[model samples]
Target: MLGVSFLPLKELFLKNFILVRDAHIEFSPGFNVLTGETGAGKSMLISALLFLGGADVDWEVFSGQRDEAVVEALFVRKGEVLRVKRTINPEKRRTRAEINGSYATKSALRERIMPLFEIHGQHENELLLDPSTHLSFFDRATGLSELQREVESLFERKVELESELRKRRKDMERLRQIRMLKEYQLEELRRAELREGEVVELEEAIERLSHVEALKEGINRVLDLLYRDDHSAYNKAYVACRILEDLGRFDRTLRPIIESLRGYGAAIEDSWRELVAYEERLEYDPEELENMRARLSFLRELEKKYG
Candidate 1:
């Protein structure tokens, strides 16, 4: 039979574990022995202790209809109460652990918690003979286990700090490279000597050059119909004003119509003069248009590159 002993076990609770449905066991202080025939669940208690100590188990055999098993143990260590719980869930394919109501990893349970129990199976002597376990026994005997635990904690902290320092250094190096690349790109854009709104201005200039003939033609048509044609609007208004002036001699109310026609004739002549001046200013330089197109293309390329 396997034997287990250690610090005082205050309580052990098991549920859906092997043949045991639900068991709540309390132990007293001092020596205790578990005696039972084969298949009487004596070894099951030993298995529960091992599993609670972070030892892996085949959950299929322990699980109930719900495919879950749980083991919780309360122990008094150095006059302090310690509680540990282990749960098996085959459906999730994972084992969960808790210590004093807080979640803990199985490794943490083995390193910090499992030392509370001393298991003595039939082959326990084999493990006792292993050289790796001797240091732990020596530390306990010399009362230096606490000191060793402090040293281990410091070492773990040092390793974590080193890892964080290395990551920061890597990130800084990447940022340095990125800054250098952006500086080079900025210099390239500066060399181009680009101006704000220059692309829009160039596009407008190009459009004016492209349709110079159409614009000139439309303006000339307006000017001719308004002033240059024999029967132009200006000439018609002048003739109408002269006829109304003669009619005013016959009726005093016709004088108002005559005055309005004269104002209309003068407005038409003013519009024709402004249009002629605008038509004279139209530019048709292909070289200037091509240069504007090229400048616009360059600016667009820069936008595409920088963006």
Candidate 2:
């Protein structure tokens, strides 16, 4: 029937609420009463005020389309505006509140805004139903509201401490998980012995080892073609030069030809000797090759495990 405030409650605004899509109610400077017929939303307005004061919400209070229900109130305190707003999200099955446009927890809303307005309804929240809290109502009747607030403040402080304890427990649990992960990572790297540039070096070595047999065979073929038999390039070149020189006695015309190809035969002989020297210097040690193969195999194992 009437709402009271410690400071002036200037206005209340509601939208998409039950039985009324939108409405704005302005309070005057003194005692006031809301006069409306039955089923005219007088009770709805009271329910909205109670909701803003942190009462249990009934989403059935939602109107058409059933999106969201908003209840906002403006209060004057020390020449500053204290705005309290509550929104009901039926889709999410949750309710949220704000004080001065900043998010406020449910307990914070209960502590901060629940006392701004008092309602005497026909609901079960009466002194007869719960006589344990009768002392608070009696204190108000006797103008002991300040003392009642002190008691409530102490209760709120207890609630805050309990909330902080719960948060710290969560933090401790999170730290435990982080420690386990770091230990696991340390063990893996210790086992892997991962090092800088190791992957690149291993890759290059593996490439070489994979093609090593082919490399040896190719070099052997080059040596054989140079001087492995008398029919080889160097041997044949020298034989032609000598036969032409032998024919020079039968005909002097062959003499010029012999002289011309003599230098060519010598060039081939010199090139073949260089090839023999290179073949002698080549390192074709099987033990070293086997060692390289084992290293490549070890590197492959490492790649599979770490990667």
Q: What is the TM-score of each predicted model, taking all chains together?
A: 0.70, 0.60
How much lDDT does each candidate structure score?
Answer: 0.82, 0.73
- Which ranges in model 2 have alpha carbons more than 4 Å from their true place? 60-65, 120-224, 242-307
lDDT value, residue 292 of candidate 1: 84
Question: In model 1, which regions exceed 4 Å deviation?
Answer: 1-8, 59-66, 78-81, 99-106, 153-214, 249-256, 281-307
- The collision pairs in model 1 are none
- State how far residue 3 of model 1 sits from its true place (Å): 7.3
Q: Pick the candidate with the highest TM-score.
A: 1
Score residue 298 of candidate 1 by CA lDDT.
86
lDDT of 2 by residue, 1-307 (tens): 4555566788889987666678888877677677878998888877887788778876554433456878898887578688989988877768889999889887777656765656566664443354544565678689998887788889889999999999999999999999998899678668766578775776666565566667667757876776676577767767887888788879999877787677776776677677666555555566766776676677677668656
- For every candidate in turn, the CA RMSD to the true structure comes to 4.9, 6.7
Give the Å error, residue 283, model 1: 4.2
